[model samples]
Target: MLYIIQTTLTLGFVYSLVALALFISYRILDIADLTTDGCYVLGMAVSVTAAYYGHPIFGIFLAIIAGMAAGYCTAFLQTRMGVPSILAGIVTNTGLYTINLMVMGWSSNVALLKKETIFMLFKHLGIGGPWMDLAIVAVIVIGCMALLRYFLSTRLGLSIRATGDNKDMVAASSINPRFTITVGLVIANALTGLCGALVGQLQKSADINAGTGIVVIGLACLIIGETVMNGKKNMTRNILACLIGNIIYRFIYAIILQTRLIPIDFLKLVTALIVALAIASPSLKENFSLYARRRKESL
Candidate 1:
């Protein structure tokens, strides 16, 4: 049970980065950037290739750069080439498959058994076991949360938020909506790439299919966070909500797995169901209340 809890926490922290990325794109920028799936694999591909060359830190940097490039392509398609945002993301995502394969030397997977990774560095420094994993992930998550909170308070960040709230208003206020959207996506995808690189290092392997359904997962986490932390006005609180929501989601999954009632093959279905319920909850509640009131009136 303790092991399960620890594992859940570790995965929660790792995936919180993805949730943060979604928060930026979906919640802040009001853009459903479907490039998440492709950018994730791109990050793993770049980081794994770098790690294979004995520079794991450099691998992370390369992953961020690759992600930003992917974001730039997506943004260019949307803003400059007159492509619809969703279509642009789909196009970039489709193209990234070939790019990811090329980065992996035309391979579909890369393994890092016995390789020295960032985590291993901690182990070598007398920090071993699951505690080290938890500590490392905690530090990264907290640091990211702080940095994001700070960034979102900046003048440019306010412009990005305003763009999401009202694009026409922002444009009329002398802020370029196009530039804000581009910057928001670049930063969002960079965080996602960082998450992917860390996940690769954590698992000691990078697989082409690892990024499948990531956008759904990230969106689900984001919705769950908003649902749980409803009406919170503070940016820090909202960021914390994202992290906590991820941990809670993982814990729920862990509990379900322990029951042995569902097959591993149906896990994705379960995730979809959870997301559906979260998305529908508010409407469901309203309808239920209305029905109850109508029944009482009829009585």
Candidate 2:
């Protein structure tokens, strides 16, 4: 049971990174950038391939670069070619499938059975033995949170936030909304690539389909976070909510899988249902309130 919790926690942190990335693109930029699915897979392919060639750190960095490049492509299509944001994202996402395949040398998948990874470094510390995985992931989550908090407080970060809130206002203030969007996407995808690379290391393998449904997972985390936390007004608080939501979400999934009440094969269905309910909770609450008001009037 402890091992299960630790594993869930570790993967939760990794997923939180994806949530953070999604938060920037979807919530901040107000764009439904679907490149996440393909760019995430691209990261896994590049990182694993590089690790296989004996360069772990370089591989991770390269994965981040690839993800950023994919974001840049999408942004270019939107700003330069006047493509709709969704269409631009789709084009980039579709292109990344081929790019991921090429990066993996046309292999459908690759495994890192004996390769060294960041997780192995934690094992070397001899801290909690089987629980070391959780410790490593915890440290990573804290570090990422700190870095993001600092970044969001900077002058440039404020501009990005403003652009998300009101593009015309930011543009009137002499800030280029297009540039902000481009930079935001780059930063968002960098975090996403890091998440993908970490997951690849955790699983010790890279599969072509590994990134399937990642956007949904990320959105689910964000929605779950907002729902549980009451949507704190502070940016830092909201970001923390995202992290907490990720852990909780994974823990719930772990519980469901462990209970054996539902067949393991139906786990995805359960996840989808939970996410849908979470997303609809706010509207449901509003409707309930309205019904209550009507009942009082009728009475």
**Count of clashes, each model:** 0, 0
In candidate 2 the C-alpha lDDT for residue 81 amounts to: 89
TM-score of 1: 0.93
lDDT of each residue in 1-299, candidate 1, tens digit only: 78888889998998998899988888888899999999999998899888988888899889999999999899999988999999999999999999999998999999997887777787876756668888887898889889999999999989998999887798688898779999999988998898899899888888999999898888787777877887247777678878888888888778778886778679899888888897788899999999999999999
What TM-score does prediction 2 earn?
Answer: 0.92
The local lDDT score (0 to 100) that residue 6 gets in candidate 1 is 84
Worst 10 residues of 2 by lDDT: 118-127
Weakest lDDT window of 10 consecutive positions for candidate 1? 229-238
The best candidate by TM-score is 1
Q: Candidate 2 on 1-299: residue-level lDDT in tens?
A: 87787888888888898898888899888888888998899888888888888887788889889889988998889978899999998899888888888988898899998998767765676666786667777787788888878888898788888988886698688888889889899888887887888788778789989888888888888888877887748888778878888988898788878888778788677667877887688899999999999999999
